[model samples]
Target: MGRGWRGAAARRTCNPRGPCCRVAGDARRPSRPRLSRSLSRRLTVPETLPSVPWRGPRHGRRVGTDPRRGPQRRRFVTLAALLALTVSALSASAPFDLASSGSDVAVEVPDPAPVATPEPEPEVEAPLVVPAATPVRVLIPAIGVDAPIEVYTDAMVAAADGWIDPTTHDVVSWWQGGGTPSSDPDNTVYLYGHVSRLEAVFNYLHSVVPGTEVTVVTEAGEIVYVVQEVLEPVGKEALPDDPRINAQVPGRLVLIGCYREPDQGRRRTTHNIVVIAHQVDSAK
Candidate 1:
């Protein structure tokens, strides 16, 4: 063997997989040797490198970081912390309000003026006296009654029922003691007619409805009246003493007739029918 081969062979030992060997008395692979303290100081970097603070771990896992990246990583973390603190302080200060922000500003307003009112005027009075007129004719178109009216004075005697006998049954009698035909509310006009005698004027006076129109003609003008009520049949014997028949109601017209009913295919007078009417104000 050559001298170099003999020297290499003496220093080496073999493993089962290949011709591999380690240095004598060495426990691990060889690395570059560390320098002595005195020499390390002289060989270090001239500029100082910042270092990151040591925190144990992230969550439960160990955090591995390179010491060479300390300066950049520490600067970035400090800036982020300062930004977060500024945001939290601003949010916690006060509620946002637009009106409160401008509370120091001033505004002006003007007042309203006064108003005036006017006074009222006075009223005048009118007269109540109505001119007099005597009733000459009576017209009731509802029961077909158009008859000439005649005055019944002390010369004529009335029956027990206050009925005066006219020259003919077709003629109607008006009591002179009763009211004259005008729009006077203080006067009442009483008219009477025969029902059982021939040519009777008020034979159908009981059939007159409450709204039938009755017109009384006089030398002055015509006075209109509206039927108010047709009183139920009263006893013929009780006419003079009956308060309803003798009532002195002003502006009223009361007509009296015999109340007849069907008896054996003919009409027989048994009671009296009284019709009450009110003067209309337009003719007054």
Candidate 2:
């Protein structure tokens, strides 16, 4: 519609450095310089943009000389330059580096104060052992029994089914293969006496209870044992198999006896009773 104006499209860019716009080419005042023919064909840019007065470098950074500020060139920096500045600031305030200061820094590593390692504890010696003497007689005041204890080896016991012979009605049979009353194989000395309802020794063994005191004489002196428990009656077959009867006993005295009723009223041989006793002290 005008003599000097040109229009090829609705929207276009005049140039990157200038005001690119749309729909209003003539909206620009004629007081400013005009756009070039080539740029006008490419973009619809305003002929004049708003201007700002430019100041020089801001805090050591460059500013544009375009006499304006709105389109000032942005400032940027590289990693090397930023890192150099950070290191310089840190070096001014940080403690001095010993490595950089070298030998004159006298970085003395103290000789670790002599660790007083305690002298190794001296080795100890073992106590000398004296074998216990053979046991002799046994005395149980609770049951009025003070019988002679005769040596009865396992062989002798086998002949009597691990019991005191019926003929020896008043004596106690000490199991000989077992260790002495004070020595190890658990110090278990098995002793059993004949029990007749009428006259045999240990006839009252079943009546004994816990805490009964029994004393035995050994050639070494006298050893006293206190009854710890009175176990329930065990059958003759099971009695032979008991761990305590077969030399597997712990360090305690095991007294065994049978219940014999006179004349088969309730059968003469009933289940055997065992009285377990533990030695409390010794008298030399």
Highest-scoring model, lDDT: 1
Relative to the unseen true structure, what is the C-alpha lDDT of residue 220 in candidate 1, on a scale of 0 to 100?
A: 70
**Each model's TM-score, in the order given?**
0.50, 0.49
Instruction: Note each model's CA RMSD in angstroms.
Output: 17.1, 20.7
Would you list the clashing residue pairs of candidate 2?
A: 12-43, 12-44, 13-43
Q: Give the per-residue lDDT of model 2 (tens digit) for 119-224.
A: 9999865332324767778999999998888887778768876555634888888878775776332557778788765688888998999999998887767777
- For model 1, residues 86-145, the per-residue Cα lDDT tens digits are 767655563543246553233444666666666666664433334557778999998899
Local lDDT at 38 for model 2: 92
Candidate 1 residue 117 C-alpha distance from true site, Å: 28
Task: Give the TM-score (vs. native) of candidate 2.
Answer: 0.49
